[model samples]
Target: MIMQVKNKYVYRSKISEAKFRQIVRLFALDLDATQISQIVGLSRVTINRYLMAIRERIAKFCESESPFQGDIEVEYEVDESYFGPKRVKGKRGRGAGNKTIVFGLIKRNGKVYTEIVPDCSKSTLQSIIRGKVDTNSVIYSDKWHGYDGLVDLGYGKHYRVDHGKDEFVNGKSHINGIEGFWGFSKIRMSKHRGINKKYFYLYLKECEFRYNFRDENLYLLILKIVRINPLFLS
Candidate 1:
């Protein structure tokens, strides 16, 4: 389906929205182009073209400015997760082998944001928070030393749940939401037996998008993804 906008712009595509959606369903099944073509009754070349377009469009969509403004009020939880080699005996923290660091923030009602960071240093973690979160939103996290002194930096409320003493929750002062997401992310990654670092963020974004939109049908959801064209049109 094509929609003409402003008379001067024309959108033409071979796939209808419904068919595009079906093709997307095949992709979600972890199928390759040839496999999707056989299942969806389309040429392999056509399927490849559509898949490439989908990836670029989604990347641009992620960078698009969100309408979320103001205090951005939502229950926020912050935490860090690691990705790397299997654990061995006697390893802790930095000793847990070379791993990439990921920071996560999730809302109480179930929205999530995640990104890769070089490390969990005070500067790195705090910078991610300042960029993605509204200063007035309450920030919840575990008692990681890296998060110390956030109040000194103008946050509305900085609450910590110390896991050292087995304190998981203190009247909703916990990071269980984000931590749950971290566990989910790891489980998804295990299917791929570890992903390349460059593609890790893309996979992470896909997971966050799926988790946040779990109520939608997987087939219809991906069809909407296939319809997007990423070329910048003036």
Candidate 2:
């Protein structure tokens, strides 16, 4: 029950490639493991396994395109969202419990890059910004204290939207795109009821991949990604 897409990487499975692809298609359609299991006639455990492998490959692909996409003046929006037990609403402080902090940077009209950070501190966020964003690119963000000092740090093109004062947009300087993505991610993730902390990174990356390529045929895109970067290394 092994299916090898390329010579080196192997996808060990009892199902045929077509069946596996059907499973993948279901997964791309955002069906949970239970739904895919029922349609594909596979056990939930088996379905979850394949899905995890697929997600691993997707995460790898997303990482390979890091520092955001396009070298030109692709305006970037940066934000941090908290995924906790009850809601997705923490900013600077992590509060308590299994509150996971995820930072994201999205190129305007392009792909999004995400990272799970220790905190929404200035240093933690700025390090990622300094690495991912170009000094010349225009950046947009809400006036979170974590996003402070970007202008002093050489990202002079940075713009801020004061959500505290209810100012979301100022000319073209708004973080509505990234903020919309946060809402999208939260809504989709809530369908799972609860996600385990250990596997949360993979899930977050999956969300990023889906949102970044929301307009494309995800099944084909995933297949292309897996084809290029095999899930299992020989």
lDDT of 1 at 33: 74
Q: In candidate 2, where is summed lDDT lowest over 10 consecutive residues?
A: 4-13
Span of 10 residues, lowest total lDDT, candidate 1 = 4-13
Off by over 4 Å in 1: 1-20, 28-56, 65-68, 71-73, 88-91, 230-234
What TM-score does candidate 2 get on C-alpha atoms?
0.87
Local accuracy of candidate 2 as per-residue lDDT tens digits, 1-234: 455342322344356667877877899999999999999898998888888888888888878865454475669999988886864455334434558888988888877888999888899999998888888889999988988889998887888889889998999999888888889888888998888888888889898989988899999998778767655522
Best by lDDT: 2
lDDT of each: 0.71, 0.82
List the pairs of residues colliding in candidate 2: none
Listed per model in order, the count of residue pairs whose N, CA or C atoms clash below 3 Å is 1, 0
Residue 176's lDDT in candidate 1: 83
Estimate TM-scores for all models. Answer: 0.75, 0.87
